[model samples]
Target: MRVWAKSGVAFNGVIAVVVGLGCALFALMAGLAWPAIVATSVALAGIAWLMTIRQDIRRHFVVKHPFPDEWHEILNRSVSFYRKLDEPAKRRFERDVQIFLGEQRIYGVEGQEVPIETKLLVAASAATLSHGRPDWEWGRTRDIVVYPKAFNDEYDVADGAKIAGMVQEHGPILFSDRDLKYGYQRSADGYNVGLHELAHVVDLEDGRADGIPGDLNWMAAMPWTDRIHKDLTNKHGRHLKRLLGNYAYTNEAEFFAVSVEAFFERPKKLEQRDPELYRLLSHYFNVDPRTGRVIEPVD
Candidate 1:
């Protein structure tokens, strides 16, 4: 696995080099005649970008807790399922995890600092859900506000109802730390409030949270909608007692978020129960949880 991972990194390096050369040649043609100097500068810039992105990605997927060694064992046991990810994916996950954790400020209702382990668990789950897409828009929405426990905020009930955490039209995310920690520690069995809310953030990427990722082209969007709707109907109609969760059936946006949690937390179960929905998610995310591999889908 290490050799394979090394080879993959080398391959990416080669590609980056080729792209750098191409950019330099283009610049020369456009009158920046210093080919050698230009190529070298561009190559260095490319390398820097790649490194930055790698760190950013790792920050989004892995979290480090300030606890004793014994606690590490417990956290590992809690997230043992994450071993399904290959090294490259794990690297990316680590970067994303760090990024996710770095952004959030966790506090108790009384304004005390929450335990790092609690925040780590919540951030880990968020990283797992968002890891599939390197281009995920929510990746840029730094700062997750986690309450030590379930807390409430003033909401305009007349407008859309606000649950635990909400992704405002243009605002930071709100989360119940107690709910997030409990949900992820329990093997992500029930609805993940973190993922649920993050899903809403991703859906808003297309400029509106209308239950659609506008970033998805029509081809991807069609299948995504079809499979999700079919699964929802089957589960809600009593034919399938609920492969996802009841919250998923609340609306299209919630359904997308709920599906994301299931995709990462229980890939095999989801595949066994709803193959089509699994396939759609795998396609859109460009990663297959079942195989921990990224390959283009054949038409």
Candidate 2:
């Protein structure tokens, strides 16, 4: 699997160094004074820095662009999470969808073209995940690879292929177009492949796919791990199994991903069946999925 990490800042740093050195070399060739050379080098480096971050600049402008009605229609028709958002949250979600589509690379494999609705669904999945966490970003590191159908471990698409979606550790994410379309099509099934894989991406943010997510502090992490171990050993009771299904028992990471699917897909059921688990998720995500609103801090 190919590794991926946020390279935008590193790329900008390299550009800055190159530009600064190039200016310094030219200044020396012209016998400019040392102070002038230093000043020119710093000036050029600053400009290079800004230039390298142009994608961020573009995203700032992208969010301001009028969201397309077609995209709105797709979200309205397919994404229950988006439809439940309040007006302001819906606007933020729209801006997020715009920024994500503007910044991240999502393309089909094998020259198969990705339709706008599929792309919007992918963006909507991302927006739903981070709607309450405005500070979060799906940094420009990995590409979203869309396959015509499910693939195996070898990444081959054929009969008997079982993998629907995958998020490699520090690698590109792969998804089956069929599964992605089915996921949004059945919004309340608690079996969304897109959300499941994206949750894996979130779990990997801490550089490991352990039960604890990156957003948790020591205080939260303790209980989170405790809950995972308990559930793994069937100690958290059968509600988790009934709510999440047997696939969740596969591993801690799978449990986390499945829980995320259930959390967003069947929020009320999850809250009713497993309130502690629901509360933990609510705190980490800082949103009430049932209402699509940012949860108020309980003082």
Candidate 3:
């Protein structure tokens, strides 16, 4: 129940040190700066102390799932993957969702409702990515900011340049509320923005996002790299496009994310079209997910 990820704690430590030194340097350049330097050092010391106690505070609040029946009903309706699970697995998923909700915050944009449904949907995306790795945590993520429509880094409402979702190394993950709901509501389009972005978070776990996620060993990494290289740089060019769709060809990270969406949503289709890549993802995720056995109740 650590509040900060290992990397995040280290990053914060580095920031504190850098800020202290920079303040000291600026004070030294001025004549009467001892008081300023003392104040800066004290502030940074407070920051360091807060960082040290963050984990303790987080541990104090961690608890088992306490969601009511209404929440489970929402899951049964919107989250097909959860609906397919047996009672035990469903409980496990619910536990994971509760854990995630406790650990991270989800903020809505422009007075949008951050209801239990929204929180559960976000949790389902996280649970699906880390179901194989129970120890996996989103400690690096501080919050998930959801905009009503699409937005850019500057929060501009771009038309054609609209972004569906994005995961950042040093900032909150961003999502469009409209697109996020669509991703789950549509279910099987192989276009889940939430899952796609969460997959990037998985890739970032090993401190990098260069096509290889943290789940793979060097042995698996090597072959995955080779396959990606062959596909991305192939002379036939459009063959990879045909196999994985156009967005995947944008880059290696996108390829992995797009493949993850397809892996979960259209596993059989992916296996039929590109069995090798499908097997790679299947091994990485540790589930076939080819049955497509979700029970989406007709409204």
Candidate 4:
């Protein structure tokens, strides 16, 4: 299996090179001391190189250290998505999990202890989503906060609280521990808090949660927008409600998240019931959830 590099390594490398050159040029134009210019360039380059290689260093250790047997047991027992992976893909998934856990922090709210099991589940959700797109990475700086129970919009846990999970645009992801466990327990229920919220993150990649992910070609974008409008307006309301649930109709972002849940949890049904939607999602995600096989789009 190819070792997974840390996310944004390439982007950071480019920034490092540009900054070093820019600083050196400015220093020379200002007739600053040669020694100081060289020092600035070297320091900037060194920092960038270190940032770029951090993931490689972590990947090397991940390769040497066998994935924990206990973690494997948990995935096998809990993640239906993991069970569908082939051996090579499984190894890749394991490596991705380790890298994610190494980089991101997961803490319990209200002093609730987060077990290894829950941590593994969080990583598994990420690995499952990015399995086909090996280059995709969760932001390194984000934290996963676990609430003891569902919380209200005000971010408080109460008897009438309704939110099971939420992803802030520039803040940490909050998940109800109760909903998180239940989502996995009923894996085929078409509702996974982890996948649902992460889907929002995907939508927000372009700095907006408008149900459109980044890098979508205009060819696909037009159709996607049309479909979202059609579904939102109830042109296919009865069928959509049966496949995805009423929450999907709440908004385009919610529809996309709900569709992601159905795509993985009930892939064949989604394909059979809504072939075009399945095809569009498969094109975007680059994998067939039903077969766990990567789909190379034709140009």
Candidate 5:
């Protein structure tokens, strides 16, 4: 993973250097004209900016939790599934884990201190699940507010009411630590609310958490919508029992999240029940958890 991370940095550095030198040469060939110098400088500046961005991204996305050595071993053991990634993907996954952790601020709400390592493990697992798609952008979720246990909150409505765990109007994701830890440890069997929520974040990449998997273009979006509609309808018809949880049927966003949990936790089942849906997810995610190549199954 270290080698892979270094390689990414090296690759970006080489590109920056090449572009910078090219601009300098272009300026010289243009007879040192003021316009040419300015253009070359701007080009060089752009390369430098990109290099800084890459470094910052790496720093933000890579996990560096200050846990005890024993805790590190425990996390490494729990996530043995991560090994299925190829070298490059593994490094990228590490980087994403770091970014997820760095972006979120976890607080102990009930005078019960939550271990940072525990939070890191949960966030890392969720981030690793989506590392394949580097293009998916979800900057709105800036933090993860965790309660030691399930807690309640008050909110205003038409009749003035209160809710718990209701994803706020525009704020961080909130999860009970108990639920998060349980989902992490046992959900390898297929129930992962963390991954489910993160999937909603990914689906929101297109600017709405409406169950539409954000695609790069209109043509891509068309096929994605068709696939989702067909799969959901087929499941509804009893032609196919839903491989994803019943919660998935709640809405588009929930469907996307629940589907993600099934994809990562029960890939073979999804493959058997809905081959087309499995294929679509595999293509979009660029990784197949069922292969056991990047992340090995837990014993």
Candidate 6:
């Protein structure tokens, strides 16, 4: 079986191999041999590569197991996006959700249990973002860490003012259970800590959170980046504040995330307010949220 652990949760596979190699130093110090050390290093490298490609491996078999009835019940209750998908798309969404759950581990912190409903909602958020891209898989993040509430980096307390959900570069994502629930519960207003955080995760796949997503080609990224820069400067205008929000002005990263929340949650309003921005994002995400139609790019 294959399993993934958040960075902090599972390093044993790597550690155990490394420790074994380190102990081999004692043998090497006595002139035992370097060939065995080389062999062990190669084995460890293979294990690491396997871990990196585990998602693709999981995808190969994940489609074989259909989503469970329990997952269906939870999705019907907790995920609005799942219910709105077309019949065939609904089936595809379910398969993607199953694959997502299989690939990522969601851990509850401070004795707070992560309910099945919470897991379904998290998967739904991911499925919604990638609904248009058939081959899209959540590759940037491996594990999800859920806390009972928002928290500061060093502090143990839940401070909603500080953080809600965060996706770190080369690190596991963090989410406040309360905020995450609230994010899905409310459908609009462009404030979903979960989607916002995951958007950051996607943006960071290319090693930067500069609002340029790796999924976009240069032809698309050029114009999209131009508009993004223009919007970033114009975020404070009276008109955009109603749509993009003041927090979006914080940076290009926030603009992308906040706009994603708007794209999914308040698509109708966003489409109404700024058709140009809406179309750009729609073409980029490959979905028109209002009607659920996949718009093809003009080549």
The models' CA-based lDDT, in order, is 0.62, 0.85, 0.73, 0.83, 0.61, 0.74
Q: Could you tell me which residue pairs clash in candidate 4?
A: none
Report the C-alpha lDDT of model 4 over 22-128, residue by residue, as the tens digit: 88998899998999999988798778777777767676786677898999999999999889888977887898888878778899987779988888888888888
Off by over 4 Å in 1: 1-75, 103-111, 137-142, 153-163, 229-241, 291-299
- The candidate that achieves the highest lDDT relative to the unseen native structure: 2
Better TM-score candidate (1, 3): 3
**Model 3 worst lDDT run, 10 consecutive residues:** 290-299
RMSD of each: 7.2, 5.3, 9.3, 4.0, 6.6, 8.1
Candidate 3: tens digits of C-alpha lDDT, residues 1-299? 12334365666677777767776777677754688788877687567756765764464455333668998888889876776677766766676676788768788876577766767788889877666555466774557888777887688667764788888876778888778888899877788888998888878767678777866778879978887777677543564467568878888888889989988887777777777787787767655465422232211
Look at candidate 6 and give me any clashing residue pairs.
none
List TM-scores for all candidates, in order: 0.64, 0.83, 0.73, 0.83, 0.68, 0.76
TM-score, candidate 1, is 0.64
Worst 10 residues of 5 by lDDT: 155-164
Native-vs-model 1 lDDT?
0.62
Segments of candidate 6 deviating more than 4 angstroms: 1-57, 110-112, 159-161, 296-299
Where's the lowest-lDDT run of ten residues in candidate 1?
A: 1-10
lDDT of 2 by residue, 136-200 (tens): 76867999999988999889998999999999888888899899999999988898988998889
Tens-place lDDT digits, model 1, residues 217-257: 77768877776677556643542236675677777787787
What is the TM-score (0 to 1) of candidate 4?
0.83
Q: Which run of 10 residues does model 6 get worst, by summed lDDT?
A: 1-10
Per-candidate clashes come to 18, 1, 0, 0, 13, 0
